[model samples]
Target: MESNEPLYVIPERYRKIENLHIVFWLLKDLCWVMLWRPLGLVMIVPTIGAAALITWQTRHIKSELLHNIAVFFWIIANAYWMITEFFTTDDSLRYYAVIPFSIGIVAIAYYYIGLRFAIKK
Candidate 1:
């Protein structure tokens, strides 16, 4: 048997980090919807669909800078939501929700910074 193959291939410089960042943001957004929706898990289907599209489109990209910027905005939005939730005095459930909401904001900021570094290279 004989086989023929291309002698060389160049691996993409930004593939791994970009993909991971996209996945993290998508998951966090899904978590947000799940946490806020009245139906809980039922809201995850639309989140999953959006994630699939984002993953598919970003899988081959070599630039993550824009994605990082997007993540930063997402964190800011989440932080605002959490702060509002924390201030609500009517329900204990709203008070308890602030914990996870704040945690999600922190996670978004962390990943956004990481992705920024990844794009800098």
Candidate 2:
């Protein structure tokens, strides 16, 4: 049995960008893990750019928009945490990552607690 709900398919171009986004995200994390500071710093631009682009592209879809926005924040938090580690051995500054992390969480929470209900109604 199939319910009557339209399927959501990302445009091929969008999907391509999304795939590339994954590559950039992974490369950024890899560079961070390997302690390649320069490359990791460079990777942030493309990684965050792709995330922002995805969020913009999905703005019309509330769920996708919220999730993509969360992804954007998640990358920011990750990059910031990476930078903190790269710059200092101490974890003192790592707490700053909480800001972006919380933003990401709020975005998801809003989607689940607010937008999800609004959409169903």
Which one wins on lDDT?
Answer: 2
TM-score of each: 0.30, 0.92
lDDT of 1: 0.48
Supply the global lDDT for candidate 2.
0.95
Name the best candidate (by TM-score).
2
User: Candidate 1, which ten residues in sequence have the lowest lDDT sum?
Assistant: 38-47
Candidate 2 lDDT tens digits, 11-118: 999999999999999999999999899999999999999999999999998889999999999999999999999898788899999999999999999999998788
lDDT (0 to 1) per candidate: 0.48, 0.95
Scored against the true structure, residue 21 in model 1 reaches a CA lDDT of 49
Pick out the ten consecutive residues of candidate 2 with the lowest summed lDDT: 1-10
Error of 1 at 75 (Å): 3.4
